[model samples]
Target: MSIKLYDLAGIDDRRFSSNCWRTRFALLHKGLPHITVPKLFTSIHKISGDNHRTLPIITDGKTTISDSWAIVNYLEAAYPHKPSLFDKQDSLKSYSEFLQHWSLKAISFPLLQIIIKDIYDRLDPIDKPYFRATREKRFGKTLEDIVKNSEDNVEQFRSGLNPLRVSLKHRNFLSGKKPLYPDYIIAAALMWPRSMSPKQILHEDDTLNTWFKTMLSLYEGIGSKQPKEWVGI
Candidate 1:
């Protein structure tokens, strides 16, 4: 049976969740056949009952898994014959895990502040209030306030990538030669902004931009198929 992926979506079927994108890229990298079910912020609970309260939940046969890292591990163990997400090495797996957290802290968090309003604008009307309320409560600030003067954050967001930029200077991917789970982690972070906001996150000369373009062309253009409005690239 094909795996069922409950992927988060915004207005016009936009799959913008970086966490979900991690799972999507993993599934593609492993050559696993799967289908995506678009989920609104308010409808995530309906996908996996109350057991899992997140997007990127996957159901394979009788097994159901949530969380991107958990799902990636499950896919690796369940389908050993398929291409490995961690290059069949424990060290790589650990590195991928570290990259996951780093991307969340260094990439996703800052990007969210810059693009939060854009995200809210793209949500379905039904999801807008819920998104606003939950996010405002989480940050202790209204969406408008959170995004206020967000443009100033652009440089901070760019500087955060200096480590990634340096890493890419040595190799085409975070995983080296061939892309791996770690590569997906960062790519998904950038995809969050690419899928919705027109804000220009990467400057023209940034090496990370080149890496991202290569990522978009991978897996037979899977990433390219998404609607993108990244502005000045």
Candidate 2:
């Protein structure tokens, strides 16, 4: 049976959230057949009624799982033949899970705000006001305020990367040679950064740049093309 993965289609594009892309990539990497349900931010109300949350929900005919991490976990268990995302060893698996959670909660939010601000700014003038208003209603703050707050976290967030850098030096993947849950977590968290980060930051380290290129190449192979309409300065 094919899994039904519901993603915010346009939002899942590189211009949007990396979390969305991670889930999509996981599906592709596992060679799992799934249906893509493209959701729009404007349709949050409808999605909430069905998902009881928001975007990136997945259903396996019998069960519905929301949240990107949860969807990934469900997939790993439901389809374990491809490879295990968590390690077979107990200690490393635990550490990998910890890193994944930390990356998503501590790192992804601020990064997402920074990335989305750029995309938000490029919306058609006629559409901008409504988009901003809806986001404010949903998030309880204007986009500018969110971006400003996110900026405050940048230095501290960068500081927190030392451990990750160390870990990356030792292993090609966050958990091992093959992509794992934490690998997806870090990749998703970096999605926005990869697209909108300053050239200096991107080129600061050869290893990091190579990793980013690898991710982009992987996505490209799976029909994860970004739409031209969404591209903006």
Candidate 3:
């Protein structure tokens, strides 16, 4: 059965959701050509046919699957002939949770302060209100107020990436020789800001930056082809 990827898109049709990007990378790794559906925040429920209102949803034939990790597992089990996201070694599921939490704590949290306003600005007008209300409630401040100090502190935010830098010092990817879920998980996190903001979040010579460039070139440059509102600002 053919696969369908329900992506979360920005106002300009830019797909920027980190979670959705993870699923996209997994789909590419599996060599699955799926239909891409661009959805705004409020439209998620319409696609899933349930109360659940999140993206990275896929409809494979008559089966509907949600969440990036679940989607990855489903594709792996269904398409065992394809390349594995788990590296065909130990299942990265437990490690994936660890990575997800650390990613949110170390990467996404700091990165969010930098990109939060940018994300708000890029949202479709309809999405802006919901995004702002929810995010503001979560952060307890105006988006602009929260991001105003990011410029001076972006350095500290990048420092959170030290572990990634050290990990990739002698490797091209997190999964040793090839990119895997571990790599894709973090790449998706970083790619979100790249797609929205015009700032250089990493040094040009950074190992993670190099690996990220390689990721952009993978899957036929799907990662880089997505339109960025601004870059290198």
**Top of the candidates by TM-score:** 1
Better of 2 and 3 by TM-score: 3
Which residue pairs in candidate 2 have backbone atoms (N, alpha carbon, C) closer than 3 angstroms, thus clashing?
none
**lDDT tens digits by residue: candidate 3, 3-119:** 989999887788898999999999988888788999999788788567557988899998888988789889889888998888666656667767877898898888888889988
- Model 1, runs deviating above 4 Å: none
lDDT of 2: 0.62
Worst 10 residues of 1 by lDDT: 224-233
Which runs of model 2 end up more than 4 angstroms from their true locations?
A: 10-15, 47-50, 90-93, 122-131, 134-141, 145-157, 195-201, 204-206, 223-233
Which runs in model 3 stand beyond 4 Å of their true positions?
Answer: 91-93, 230-233
Residues 1-233, candidate 1, lDDT per residue (tens digit)? 79999999888888999999999999999999999999887888887679988888999999999999999989999999999999999999999999898888898889889999999999899999998999999999998999897989988889889998888898989889999998999999988999889988998778998999899999989888887778644
Question: What does the lDDT read for residue 207 in candidate 3?
Answer: 80
* lDDT of candidate model 1 versus the reference: 0.90
- 2 against 3, candidate with superior lDDT: 3
**Per-prediction RMSD in angstroms?**
1.0, 4.3, 1.7
Q: Could you give the candidate ranking by lDDT, starting with the highest?
A: 1, 3, 2
